[model samples]
Target: MLIILLLVVFMIGTFFGFMFIKNTIAHWLVGGISFLLLAGSVTMLTMHIRDNWGMKEVTTSTTHQIYTAGDKSAPYGMMIKAEIGKNTDNYVFVYRNNEKSEKADTNFKPDEKHISEAVKKSATYKLVDDTKATVTTKTTRCVWSSDFYKLLFSVGGEQNELVKQNSVVSVPKDTWLVLTQDQVKKLSQEAPAMQKQMEAQLKADPQKAAQLAALQKSNPTEYAKMQVKQIKQLLGITE
Candidate 1:
């Protein structure tokens, strides 16, 4: 819509410039400038629309902590801002670790209930201490954020234990941490090879894959269903 408007405006500008400018060189220059602007406007508008519609927003929170080597010293921690409303029913958590980054498999229908269950059952504290954290209910969603260091202090001596048990500790940045239903559908269509690649990688590196495998083993019923769904999608067996 904006592109069409810009094109129309450019055409009018070009027509006026050609009619008013007696100099051939000035007229041609003005016309060329208007055309270039029109092309640029169209390109920008197309990209804006594609980004807004093609990609779903996945809410991500990053918690950073600077831990001392051995001492339970006070570590500085901060939660990255959460994106308010990007996904229909899912959010992703992303963070950095060991100079390398990793992303978890996408989650679906991650509402307040799901998140509460995940926090209680999943050892996210092993990654970051969130005991003092509380969820606040928004008009359509729940939100929570905490200082990483404060969480650690709340954990006391059990911080290392939590770290050893959590996969959230090493999640990657800028990777799709979670996928909404629409985003998942699009990903399934466009990146069928992704699942196969992940499977092959897991097979080749059992130790490194243990983290995610542990998650699946601990929740076999849920994880199994997820795997089957992904496999069906990857094999073009959409139902």
Candidate 2:
């Protein structure tokens, strides 16, 4: 609306100042003002086209089933590979929306920097977008705030800008784990010993081992959760 109004005023000023007015100074003054208005209109139009005006930040939330990064067919329990930094709190989460999927989906690539968090919640995974701004936030762009703003610009095809995408993944806290890089290294080095120890514990209790074997065949998901619980106990990892 402002752009159109400026254009209309420019047209009127041009017509009266050049075609109707008789005075020289008045004619040049009006023409100059009109040209300034026209320039302002064109500059504003360009900015709107470039999506650098009239935008707002919006947040949305979603949920998906999460899995650990490992074998796709039988992934470990939900875990976050934390990237330790002086001030950054970043997490890498692997997930799969489909229960039968053979591959896991990740929120960010392994090399990319992002911030994330894990919260204690239900068995189902919940992904909530946070509004906090961090150093890793993406570049800002603008979109039409509403239909009214689009009408004012006369260009309604604009998409919202992404500032940051911080995911807060909620998982069953009791079954999930967050391990740092050093801790992960230690776990990898001691994996053989831990596995043998776990096997020993199961063998010591024949009924428990049989029940786990049955559970694995009947309900693989529950079986995975049970395995994670046992590993946490062996490592003395608490919720």
Candidate 3:
């Protein structure tokens, strides 16, 4: 829509060129501004489609899958398949932006130690003993200034909240983190102390084992969801 309007404006400006040949300055000014508008409109539209991320329905029962990028140039893909009460990443988030992130150029890669410390100092994630972090939304946005694109991904929801249940990997920036279901399995491995207890509980309860088998047969992703609820119940983690 906007592009069409810009094209129309460009045409009107071209018509101005013929009308104002006598006033060369007027023609030059209108023509230059129109060209910029056309270019800007094209750039914005391209970025919008490139940066779009939205929820998609799950269609598989597989426990995990890895999605590779179409190519390195368009590097990005991972979507966590989690149930809000089920699967989650036992993790803390440390964030960093580009050189212009701060008023002064820090030109430094974010250190995990510093990011972890910041998470600990925060009132929200401070006391979260459980490993899994609930992440809500994920968006990959490319910030274009003069020429280079500064791309970044944002993970939302409180630190303790289950990481986003859907796959919304940050594009090109940190695409590797959210690419596959392996992340959830990795997170489950983090709190082995708690998992050991859950494992023993499941072992003793043959009925649960049978049920889990049946559930897994039907849908592995859904099975993970059920297991997550079971573990939280055992650990007494609140919503």
lDDT (Cα atoms) of all candidates against the true structure: 0.41, 0.57, 0.40
Best by lDDT: 2
lDDT of 1 by residue, 159-238 (tens): 22211112233222111122234544565475547757888998999986897678666965455345545544554544
RMSD of each: 22.7, 8.5, 17.9
Model 2 residue 154 CA deviation (Å) reads 6.8
Task: Tell me the tens digit of each residue's lDDT in model 2 across 159-230.
Answer: 654444454555554344455556556667787897788699999999988987888889875776676676
Tell how far residue 203 is off in model 2, in angstroms. 4.4
TM-score of each: 0.24, 0.53, 0.24
Query: What is candidate 1's TM-score against the reference?
Result: 0.24
lDDT of model 1 at residue 45?
54
RMSD of 1: 22.7
List the candidate 3 regions with Cα displacement exceeding 4 Å.
Answer: 1-190, 228-239
Tell how far residue 231 is off in model 1, in angstroms: 32
